[model samples]
Target: MIKITFIEHNGTQHEVEAQEGSTVMEAAVMNGVPGIEASCGGACACATCHVYVDPAWKETTGSPEVMEEDMLDLAYEIRDESRLSCQLRVTPAFNGLVVRVPEFQA
Candidate 1:
């Protein structure tokens, strides 16, 4: 399992473990983490699962693909660190990854 930490805009933190191959969004939803709506259910069609990869883990999380980037364009308060959690597949390297959820999502 891969462990990931999610920090809400208000600074609430949720740490959860998820099976490898599962998306970060799935982990958040399964663990009842607040702020991730996952409206498209990991389909990469909605921006509600958006998160900001911690600068230290940004390289490890990698960059989003064209499709995800396009979708992220619709996310609220998009930033250079912005990413759609549904597109981030979990891996052993993500054991301590940290992400920040926006206050509001589109």
Candidate 2:
């Protein structure tokens, strides 16, 4: 299992263990972590699953593709670390990964 920590805008932290092939959005939704609506599922059409990758793990999390970057433009409070959770696949390498939910999403 891959361990990931999701911190809400209000500082509520949800630590979840997910399958290697699953996406971060899947882990959050499956674990009932608040703040990730994932309105468009993992289609990359909506940016409701926006999150900020911890700066220390940014390289490990990888960068977004063109499609994801485009969609993120419509997300609220876009930042250098901003990423759509649906676009992030979980892996053993992501153990202890940290993501922060913005105050609002797209």
* Reference-based TM-score of each model: 0.97, 0.98
Please provide, for model 1 over 1-106, each residue's C-alpha lDDT reduced to its tens digit, 9 standing for 90 to 100. Answer: 7889999999999989989999999999999999899998999888999999999999999999999999998999999999999999999999999999999999
TM-score of model 1 (CA atoms): 0.97
| Residue-by-residue lDDT tens digits, candidate 2, 49-98 | 99999999999999999999999999999999999999998888899999
Judge candidate 1 against the unseen true structure and give its global Cα lDDT, from 0 to 1: 0.94
Give RMSD (Å) of candidate 2 vs. truth: 0.6
Which pairs clash (backbone N, Cα, C closer than 3 Å) in model 2? none
RMSD of each: 0.6, 0.6
Q: List the residue pairs that clash in candidate 1.
A: none
